[model samples]
Target: MREIVIGGAQMGPIQKADTREEVVDRMIALLQQAKGAGCDLVVFPELCLTTFFPRWYMEDQAEVDQWFEREMPNAATAPLFAAAREAQIAISFGYAELTPEGRHFNTSILTDRDGNIVGKYRKTHLPGHSEFDHDRAFQHLEKRYFEPGDTGFQVWRNMDAIMGMCICNDRRWPETYRVMGLQGVELVMLGYNTPSVNSQDSVEGLEKRLYHSELSMTSAAYQNATWVVGVAKAGDEDGHPLMGGSMIVDPNGYVMARAETEGDELIVHACDMDACSFGKSTIFDFARHRRIEHYGLICSQTGVVLPD
Candidate 1:
């Protein structure tokens, strides 16, 4: 059995006033905990290093750039990498990336057991609007801050398994998983900082929001016959609340473990990568079941067209 013990490191909120140094300290603490728990890999939430900055609108380019990292393993995050290397554990986390060419993206990276980065994924399905809107209960200016990811869905061979990565809103889209599923991915990791309540609909509460998050991940895991690890940066960030339903799902879509609180928590599970074989060879065998010829419209059109 190709078994891997994975840790879902759910982080509490990072206030705007918090420094990267301080945030890295919190992550190192979690890494130490994961080590004690015998985890081979640890997954952290999207934008794990900072507060969910997209909630506020800022016109000053310099001010906006402060939240982005021009380089990974920079001065602020080097220690976390060092710790992971010393512990001999693989880790994955999300951060705001600022390219030398002056481009920005919501990105995540995956590392091998020796702490070498093996893969990177930029978030494709960016939610919220770019422009400031008076209608929104709060601004979610992700579009204003980041360009849609140019790196399409891709997978890598790591930890003796075919693995893939996505971030936040990308989890809600079936196409995200379908692309990786077609690539024969065995494990998928994603992170999120979703609000506890819907900004557009006041009636949608925290429970319903959490339900939708689980529904998306569970369905995707079963349909693709792959294991999924979803971690969250939860609890109140300043006054805005982000929901926490961090979990690990088996290939059959059963929740093996979950976090009970919206706090800094770690959920661990021993997953056998070979367990994916049954569904992939039988029910979800794309080679035997998928009919791509009839699905031209999926790539041909971006929006719905009415029947003539």
Candidate 2:
């Protein structure tokens, strides 16, 4: 059996005053806890290093630059890698990436059991507006800070499974999973920081927000027949409360483990990669079930209009 024990390490709030070093130390603690629990992998949340900084509109470029990491194994983040290497636990976490060219992206990286970088993914479907929206309660200017991800959906073969990664708003997109699913991915790890309130439309309620998040993840897991671990950077960060329903779903779309509180928590499960074989080889098999002949409009059109 190709079994991988995964730990969904849901982080509590990262206060505005919190430093990257402090956050990394917290992550190391989670990794050590997961190691003690016999987890082969630990998945942390998006933007795990700092408070949700996008909520505020900033004018100082240097101040914003401070939030992005220039190097992966740089001084600030080295300890987490060292701990992972020592404990022999693979880890996936998200952070703001500052490329050498000075471009910024919402990014996540996966490390092998020995703490070697195995894969990286930049979030493609960036949510929020480029300019500040005065109508909303607060700002969500992800489009202003981060460039659209150049890297497409890609999968990696490591730690005895075909694994893929996505971040934050990317989790809400079906295309995100389908692209990796087509590549024979057996597991998908994702991180999110979903606010309970909809910045675009204030009329939306919290219950719907929570429901939608779970629905999107559960559907993706079952449809692709892949195990999904979605961890969240939850709790009230600088007065902005993010939803904290971090969970692990099996191939049958069943939630095997979930975090109960909006604090630092670990929800773990043993996922069998072979559970995906049946779905991929039979009912959901792309080669067998997908009929692309008449489905060109899906890609050809930008929108659909029905009769009035």
Prediction-by-prediction clash tally: 0, 0
**Candidate 1 per-residue lDDT over residues 1-308, each given as its tens digit:** 99999999999999999999999999999999999999999999999999999998999999999999999989999999999999999999999999999999999999998878999999999999999999989988999999999889899999899999999999999999999999999999999999998989989999999999999999999999999999999999999999999999999999999999999999999999999999999999999999999999999999999999
| RMSD (Å) of each candidate, 1 decimal | 0.6, 1.3
Q: What is the alpha-carbon RMSD of candidate 1 to the true structure?
A: 0.6
Pairs that clash in candidate 2:
none
Candidate 1's error at 253, in angstroms?
A: 0.7
Error of 1 at 34 (Å): 0.4
lDDT of 2 by residue, 133-242 (tens): 88888899899899999999999999879999999888888989999999999999999999988877788887788788888899999999999999999999988999
TM-score of 2: 0.97
- Model 1 stretches with alpha carbons more than 4 Å out: none
Please identify model 2 stretches exceeding 4 Å from their true place. Answer: 305-308
Candidate achieving the largest lDDT: 1
